[model samples]
Target: MAAMAPSPGRGAHKHGVIALILCLLVLQREAWGLLCYCEGLCPDHNNFNGTCEAKPNSFCFSAVETVYDVETDQWKEERTYGCLGPDELGLMQCRAYLTKHQRPKNISCCNESDRCNEHLLPQIIHHKPSVAPQGNFLESLLLVTLPLGFVALLAVIMTVWFRYRQRESSMLEYNKPLGLVIGPNDTLSDLIEQSSGSGSGLPLLVQRTIAKQIQLVQSVGKGRYGEVWLGRWRGEKVAVKIFFTTDEASWVRETEIYQTVLLRHENILGFIAADIKGTGSLTQMLLITDYHQLGSLYDYLQNTTLNYFSMIRLSLSTSCGISHLHTEIFGTKGKPAIAHRDIKSKNILVKRNGECCIADFGLAVKYVSENNELDFGNNRKVGTRRYMAPEVLNETINMSCFESLKMADMYSFGLVLWEIVRRCASESGDRYLLADEYQLPYFDCVPPDPSFEDMHEVVCVRGVRPDIPLRWHYNEVLKTMSKVIQECWHANPAARLTALRVKKTLYKFHVSDGTKIV
Candidate 1:
């Protein structure tokens, strides 16, 4: 019927073949059921694509683990999926194994699926807080380096400034003319120019240093301003005119006149230096100048007599001094014409060479023609009473006329000549005679220290002058001196002899007397 009563062998073979198909189907289902996804990040067990081939008797597993990164010094979470045995399927097993061996932060879950481990395990989602650096590397470097850089820059600047100042100081010291370079032939004017670049005077510091080194030896003279002292500087004698602080104006006036350009001359006292020294209330104002041991004409006349030659030298030298004072040089460096308002024997110094120089310029006045300026100095009446000319005694002189001042000086010069001639004894041609005792012009008419009133009465009111001795007429030199004196002391100032004329007349006499005047 369906298989012709089915042969027993064929039937058995057909049954056996059906059993083999069923067994193959069952075996394929068991093989597929046992398969796991086996994808993991493990380098040792995974392939190059971070996945493993499906394995038997294993399950899909997910693990949330932590590992210490030694280089980063931080805790990191590492996730992996791979086949796990039945014993590893429990959370505690994986957790304990990972915690002990792999240092896992948390255990895993297992599932049997194709890609059950594809998604990460759900956890508390603990995120590693990002660590922020304290400061930028560049900023930290600048903070440390910037201040040191500034300090180094400041040190360099200070060193440069210090060197510049040192160089400037060295130049200044080198420019100063020390006394060692000065020669015997060098004049003070030359020294002033060499030291100051302009012939202005000594530098202020040089003046102070010189003043400080001076040693006062003795008081030489006294005046209304203050005392005159003989001082020594490096064994060189110098006259120190010291004024009381109260009379500082007089000292300043004198110094100013002395410093006039082109004012240095043999007939003018040589200015050395001027300074103010000491501390506070003890300060002393000093004017330093060349000193002469012979003292003033007044002192010399009072102590020593003179011969005819000495007499002529004194009169002519005084005339030369006054004439030079009246001269106004015209050039780049010029001197204004000056008048010695207080000309007297005491204000004239006698040099060792028998010459004279005008001194005591406190009451002097300068006349500048270009500006028509007349400095009528201090108002104080300051001439020796006995030496006042007629115009001066009567206060009737023309103040504006420069010639009137010259005339007044001439009148005083006449009196000085009289004083010089009275002490002279002619020694020419074996005519040896002792000279008369030195006396002031009006010594007979007034007291030794005559008052202004006494002088005014004798000179202006009475029109009296020193009498020329009748004996002078006997000698030619005395007679000529007497004539010059008469012309100089005329009551009318205009009629007075000029200083130049007086000097010329004395020079002529020196020639006529068989003497060659130098």
Candidate 2:
């Protein structure tokens, strides 16, 4: 996208917006429905100045995009004005949106009164190569440019300061990953059902509108792809993952996967928005999701030990989530099977309900049955060192086969299960037993932050696995769990149990042992 100069009409637009907002606040809400002014790219092009009534809960939207006219060598805006469909989540989903450049793109939504979205909101565009037209006066610049520049400058400084300090889980040390659309009487799920939702996630337009509305609360954690921060929008806390510009591919891939048809599940990270913001060299690529309290499964296990029942819930919920990812739907709106290549404890988050959901899709692969294609999500598939499967460590993985990747995930899941179970406190008939200190898989065999060579030597060459305590055998449920873990991390990838099989095995314990999966 080429950066260009500021649009000349920007000054007039701001005055129009202030007046527009004031008018919207005073106008009475239409009793029947919203009546929006339809113009430009209206459904009935002939009736450009027509007005249309919006359906219940729907809002008014208007958009303008400056398109380059190749033949004329000039930028011309394509306008869209009408009653837009209901946003996937709720009426509150509507937000102000704009893209910077000489050729700017602007879209806005309003529901305060009839014809509330007649004009797009004012936006400051940066990195324009040319100057504003001579006709735009000094007074116009003073009134519009000065105050907007001050606010923008202050915001940029704060964002940079918070971002510069972003690294690891020290900031959100007490936080956890809260599920977006789950728990008792989840209102967000009902919002999705009531709206004209695709049952996937928020639409791209809605997501982009939301991107600028978020205010970073604090740095949550950092990783290879980017740093994550807790952010707030309209009093609701959300997770904002700001990726390095070089990791742009990962951001796009995760966004695409999250927007997959019918992909919204209780056990997967809840995606809210994906956006690229800022100007020129200072651009930021961001992926926003719902914020849960505890940072990650690894962080949670380290800070808080769990009871046996909580341990089982985490294990079972995780397997169920993975199973949904692995299984492909067949309908027209079906989703292809996805394999989460990096499935370590750090990538799994524990919700307040004592269940785990999978996160991090930068290295995920999707299998499309229609064309028998494998999408590696445009990343150089790099498995985590500590949770590397035997085949992955030895470089024997069949990248061509989708099942090969799924099997590798099982191996990582086994390591995560071990992490969770190690913190579980259980009781035998005759004795009370508490688990040992939380540790990563192969903590004893390899040094901290193991290299590829170190993991290869420890896992593939030595044929080693995480040890199970003899005390685990005393408890019937723990004994069964230990067996399942063994099968998942088998030396042979094909020999490893499928995700569904693992979920079934854990589900059996849930039913017989009087423990709940939720």
Candidate 3:
């Protein structure tokens, strides 16, 4: 049919409808756009402040954060205001992940009006001079005198406390025995059994005695929690991990984990004592253990190359330590299964007998099978970015399942194995030139210090991993090791090998004169 030409009135009505539709479209666009105030503190000390035009259905947000300043060794508060889209919580978590040292204190969102976030948070004012109060001479005199009296009283109390503490410490040091020796010919195992009788730690008196006699030599290491010192106790060297006052919780946690009944395995770091020592307002949290002169595996690998036998022994010993940690013992003095949340080469120490012992239990969690309970500790989520598992990087880990935690540990253990293999030399002493640098996992794909976003992008989004050298396929043992590493870090968390499985695989591969198992 032929299209009909509209009459004047009909055409006018059609044009009016078209104009109305166009007007509604413009109004809709205006409704979708909203202005919000934006400001932030960046890592480079740059100021970010401006008005942001929010996207469709977005909201304005105000956030306060606490960041640790490496240069000053202090925590600084940061305030930020900005527009956040539908994925608000996820975006905030990503930001937290990117900044390992920066943690969110408060984050609030509002969608009430344009510029709703303006002045939502207080700005940090630096170095504002205090104005002197207007007062007569007599009033100022009274204020000064009262404060002076208070200070004098405080000084007297402090002097008395100091003298008392000095006298007590001297007396205690004189009377206390130097060390707790089960017998003159007793082994470490015998000592451990005697000290911890169906309990997690040594007797309180024993801990105090050990702390009183140790003489600190020098600082051997420093970490986020505090410093580690080399000390001499009863003419024998010991490692003293001294926690800062702020890290009291971590000190307590590590001590509890280390003193787990039946946790004293040869491949695990030996716990000697835990004590709180000091005077007045300043007290030191001390964790005493056996000293390993070779230091951490990371430090040792940097300086020395490992032969095949040494590599297998180190790998097996580490696996054994982790397996024992995961194994739950049964009995009255039984130990619960444990998961080492932050497993890495640096946390593994090399002992004098050329074996590896797992150290640093600050982030460990214990699972009690009897009550079907898991103690998810209150420690901060801190793992080496390069060694994080896919589930952890993506924040999809099942926290309720104890097995999930063990699987994550296995993933990290696999990465540690990769590190060991990179430094391995042939039994015939043939060094692989390309793999000699002792590179960390994903070193080639990410930055020297990969941020959370960088790792998330590579590991979660793109699924990139450390490149396996094609040359490794030529050697049978190296090829087998590569296969094991690949299986350990499978993208699917459920597909990874257990610590026991890894230990058994390495044990079967070993052809050297080492202990049969951990």
Candidate 2 residue pairs in backbone clash: 4-102, 4-128, 5-128, 175-293, 175-294, 176-292, 176-293, 176-294, 177-292, 178-292
TM-score of each: 0.61, 0.62, 0.62
Whole-model Cα lDDT of every candidate shown, in order: 0.75, 0.78, 0.80
Candidate order (lDDT): 3, 2, 1
Error of 2 at 179 (Å): 27
Per-residue accuracy of model 2 over 1-518 as CA lDDT, tens digit each: 89987886997899899999877654534335678887654555565557877766677877665655668866665666777765532222222443333354466777877788786553433322244343246668788999999999999999988786673343233122212222244343343554335556654554666688789989989999899999987767889999998998888888888878778889998877788998776999999887888879989999876766778788999999999999999887788999998898889888888788889988888898889999886778586889889888788899899989899999999999988888887777755676689998998998998999998888898889999988788888788889999999999888999999999888776433353221
Model 1 residue 156 CA deviation (Å) reads 40
For residue 425, give model 3's deviation from the true position in Å.
1.5
Model 1 lDDT, residue 28, Cα = 66
lDDT of 3 by residue, 225-278 (tens): 889999987578889999989888788889889877888888999888899988
TM-score of 1: 0.61
Winner on lDDT between 2 and 3 is 3
Query: What's the lDDT of the predicted structure labeled candidate 2?
Result: 0.78
Span of 10 residues, lowest total lDDT, candidate 2? 174-183
- Candidates in order: C-alpha RMSD to true structure: 24.1, 29.4, 34.2
